[model samples]
Target chain A: MAIPTGPMDLVYRVLDDQLVDVEGQRCGRADDIEFDGGLGERPLLHAILSGSGTWHRRLPRPLRSVGARVFGTGLVGADVIQVPWDEVDDIGSVIRLKARARDLGLGQGDRRRAETVARLPDS
Target chain B: MKKVLQLALGIIAAIGGFVDIGELVFNAQAGAFFRYRLLWAVVVGVIGIVVFAEMTGRVAAVSGRPVFDTVRMRMGLTVGLVTLIASLVINLITLAAEVGGVAVVLNLLFDLNQSTLILLAVMGLVVIVYFVPFDGIERIFGYMGCALLVYVVAAVHLRPEWHQVAQGVVPSWHPSALYAYFVVGVIGAALVPYEVYFYSSGAIEDSWGVKDLNLNRANAALGFSLGGILSIALIMVSAEVFAPAQIDPGFLGTTALGAQRAFGETGLLLALLGMLFAVGGAAVECAFSGAYTLAQFAGWEWGKYRRPREAPRFTLAWMIFFALAFVVVETGVDPVLLTEYAVIFSVVALPLTYLPVLLMASDRTFMGDHVNGVLGNVIGWAFFVVILVVSLAAIPLMIITQGGSG
Candidate 1:
């Protein structure tokens, strides 16, 4: 019933989502997570986070490139991609989001988002 | 705590976000034309911006989305597209004026020719904006923008009747129509829609959530109210300087020169600084506003706070937007004409821009438990109605008045 979070708890939605490791690296965010309510067993949080590709289907092709650019191809190791829970040394003021930011494949999917957005009305 | 620093950031951004080229030229213009009699409209605009900015900041903090995102989800594609086009036009026009304004400032300070400096200034802004950290740029401009307060000092030096200015706070049906027009200009300049766009998007860029609502209110009120104070000072100075001379200011340069009437060389430096930074500050806000609106419209990750590479699409949109302003400026368009068109177009887009924010801020889906409280709704709706009326009359008024010069 309790999620061990403070302000950070408010940062998310659809609580109990999975956060997977970055492709071939040790970092990623909670793309999807599941929680089991078994009384006798230890409460388990299975977060399923991959790369930006997880949200790619909803995005059109051009939009997908935006995701790829901001995240990564998920085929190679990079910063700005998803950061897994383990790689998070801690949640301080800065997201400390797996300090390997220097190596992340930034802007990998920018074109995709731009294209998809351009096609839509900017309401 | 660190939260306090963040709150300070919000306040600073609010200061930078409060007034723009419209206020710079129009407010001073209002003073030159009508003096304290039109000061009420400035106050009305100030209150309107504060109310709208408050709602927008609240919306951003609660929904974790900027104003455009909410507009898109609420208004849907067709109407949203219309808003974007309108907002973009105003942004470009305002951007042109500010770009020209920067040139004028440099002209005043360095004795450079305005023509020579115009393109150079626009390009310089595009370059700084391309690489400067969004937060850093905002802070620098926001705090330094405080320099414009010297207007208040000069206005006070003249020692006008406070009660007469206070009397203008309420609408007078018995007053001259020209007086009414002047009042409308003050309000029009103050309630410029781009200001609210820049404000709300700035809130999102700062990553505000419900926890920051109080700070949002504080910043909107404090920073904007202070801006109002400076605007009134402009009105007073113009009343004092130009009224006796029977001189009407046709250019922003003349408006800056009015600063000399009350303060001497010291006044000149202060006015120059104010014009330079005021114009510069507005440029930054409108530019980011352009990018944020486009990015939010399409659901792309966008914020000045984010690295350029991280929000590539967003950054590119802004860069392109800035580039377009270059195209407009390089054409040697008159900034005053540009300001006139921009203000009128902003008047046209008034309802579309504010309505969506009012709707979403009231809705539970996006706001969750943090929806608009009673005071916010009342103020928001009241402003909505007023803006609608002004928007309806703006074109006709412009036509009849021949864009206010007639």
Candidate 2:
């Protein structure tokens, strides 16, 4: 929640219209902004990143779309998705994540979507 | 500039995705019958859509989950499935109506066999959806959809009495049962439940979250309000031309002539393009909504953002529904009848789809501090009440007014 203000507050911006991830990679778009203060005071930008849930959640009711959505938990939680302020590899054509999304936490429960469509002919 | 561009997706999506066949047909019908007398319904529908859409967007942005994903948590999976089924039915009817609208417009332009033209229209839609990549889908449709601006231009061109229009904007006591039915019709059509399902699901597709709340709010207000305005404009033109003549703009062709009467030949071309685009977009949205609600409920991957092969089952479900709707249109059913029925059934499904989203928006575990504020709850409940009344009265009104023509 706390975004740093100065250069130390270096927000991992996707400059010049850079994208976050490509293909079906574990990396996702900036889903949320994490911040720090002491667990609570001068809340500042702790990190900027995406959630694994965003990847799978992008799909509709009965199926999960993992391409940009997501599939694992390692890329989730409070820490895995967080890369401090130092790990944002390079801000280039894509904001390449330092670690693979699979290493983040791809698991059975991770990529599945909740059922929103009922009569989908079980294919 | 990139920030502007990223934000432009929200705006363009709002603009192009906002207006649909529902707005085009219903507003024209209302305008022909009541002029500005039912103007209040459009305003109300706009407010209702804004309250709920903003909530759904904020939930997606803050909680990182779309509304339907939370529906199962609140209602057990079975109840949630019931909602999905009900919502799917509404979406099917909506898709059929839009497909029919597409066919009718083709018939207007080419005078082809309605059945053959319907299949042609469906094919056009399938090709558009099948090949287009995901990211470009919204921007492409939204921008190309701006051609609908012609209806608003035509309304202004007609120059109706501003004083009389202002009076219609004020809600009045109308003794005519038919007029009351017309107001309910606009309210029903203007706030079709699938629009929110499609809209919020879209927020998820774009990977929006707490940071993008502003853009989401702007999308709801700008996109839906623009849609509501277009609906009113269609009504205005109809009222200006047909009200005096006492001619009902029942068919797609008649509605086009409403524009044609005001803008001459240019109006006809603009009307054709506008109707085709609006109807086509609505068909895509309704089909996807059917897919989105089901996929989100079941924990399956489903999105246009992915290639069809990636989420094969989810894509298959949506594609099946889309294909079925295409077939339904091929039966030569009248689009006007199809839309009227869709709106009424949508009135029934309204309470079901909305209640889950409203409750989810306020859930502390899901939404955290970003949950609905006091004003949000107030507006949300107020709209729910309106939905309840319409749900209760939809059938009776349809019977009593004999589908609003009596």
Candidate 3:
């Protein structure tokens, strides 16, 4: 696939896309996107943000609290995990990363829950 | 032969999986009250679901995004959050209704304690979800649920006027508010959002790729159309057996009587067995739908394809939903009544649930050359408009009809 050059359509292409690790394991979503630049300069993509509470903040004012209440904050002691844009391997149906989930501190909740689920018979 | 069997099984599963507690009772009520007049609404609603399901299934196959994932992406955070919450609440109510419905069937078959039956129902559901593979679950429930085809045969045996049944294919408006409510209800019940959510996610669960696109279309078209035929058969049976006598098919048992009147004890047994599997399938579907919506929206690792340990949150979500539904059922609420309310609320959520699927299906960025063709767009938009109108008109109709009391 040709690398997307120039401005990328973050909203349509990247934001809300599924995050898959280098090993092709499912991890999380691109809950939010971060950018960095000075006022007069074009902002460069910084990182992708994820975790339970991160996306809720993007909800409108009235629904923000409701989102937070429903989705909760910092599930499994991780409020948010960020992957620098440089680490992004490719963007397609899913946002692929160059690093494994644990390396990027993603999927912490899933790993934690998996341990408990593993103890169950035939799980 | 293997391909043929797979397609046949897929269609059979869709046919049997289509009618839930809501469709079973609602179609019967419509038939008992208005006889064959409301059959057009079933056709309309079934067509709508076919279009919607096909679009969602296609999107999942081509793009690997399920309905809830599309819900968040297209609608954005604010509206998506609202949609998620609304769908989750409605799905919970639906789950409760299905669990309670299973208990209702069990109670009719054997004189068991309602609470104990409800518990047994959830336990049965838990065991199935834990032990059965996805295809096995579909086959067990889908094939068993086909026992409901008894109604089709019974409807024919009862032998209503062929001309009258034909007339039902053309939509006609009746002056009564009760008539309008039933119209809205039959359509709403047919277009329940869980079907699409389950379908799209199931596409992903089955690991459907572009190669499965034709199969997806076949499944949606053939499966749901046959399912619609079952709904029509239900109406025909109820119209023949209950309409003339002025018997209201308000309860699940009442709905089965249409079969009993035609074939005696054998018919009754088939009806109950079918209801058990169909409603049981729905309970499982509803539970998985809730899990899919939450996990997909939140971007959690989810799918029955994953082991319970592999997709822990997803596993827990469905299990929690079943436990919560059991709690709801324990409160002694009427499952049939709950079915009515769930249908009504589900229709209200229909537009939110469907619009994203339509948008994403048509978007070239997501779907590439596989984006909905012109015919798909026309039917998709037309049904979208119909569901929106029905959503707006649903509450008032329910109120005016006093939940179809009149």
Residue range with the least summed lDDT across 10 consecutive positions in model 3 chain B: B8-17
lDDT of 2 by residue, B132-173 (tens): 755566656665566677878888999988888888887786
Please identify model 1 stretches exceeding 4 Å from their true place: A1-109, A112-123, B1-19, B174-177
Sorted by lDDT (best first), the order is 3, 2, 1
Tens-digit lDDT track of model 3 for A5-115: 877778888888889899877888888888999999998889988876776678777777776787776453367788889889988888889999989998888899999
Ranking by DockQ: 3, 1, 2
For each candidate in the order shown, give its overall lDDT on alpha carbons: 0.66, 0.68, 0.86
Higher-TM-score candidate of 1 and 3: 3
- Candidate 2 lDDT at B53 equals 77
lDDT of 1 by residue, B1-406 (tens): 6544454444444444444555666666677666666777777788888888788888877866567766665665447667987888888888877787777678778887666788778778776666566566766676677777778888888887788788867765434545555555666666677677777877766777788788888878887788788788878888888877887777777777777877888888887787677678778777878877766664455677765655667777776777787778768787767876777778778788889889978987557778888987888899998998878877777776776775
TM, chain A, every candidate = 0.30, 0.39, 0.86
lDDT of 2: 0.68
Q: Give i-RMS (Å) per prediction.
A: 11.0, 13.4, 1.1
Q: State which candidate, 1 or 2, has the greater TM-score.
A: 1
Which of the numbered candidates is closest to the native, going by highest TM-score? 3
Among these predicted structures, which one has the highest DockQ? 3
Per-prediction DockQ scores? 0.07, 0.03, 0.76
Report the lDDT tens digits of candidate 3 across residue range B207-300.
8899998888887887788788889999999998889999988889898888999999999999999999989988888899999999998888
Off by over 4 Å in 2: A1-123, B1-19
The RMSD (Cα, Å) of candidate 1 is 9.0
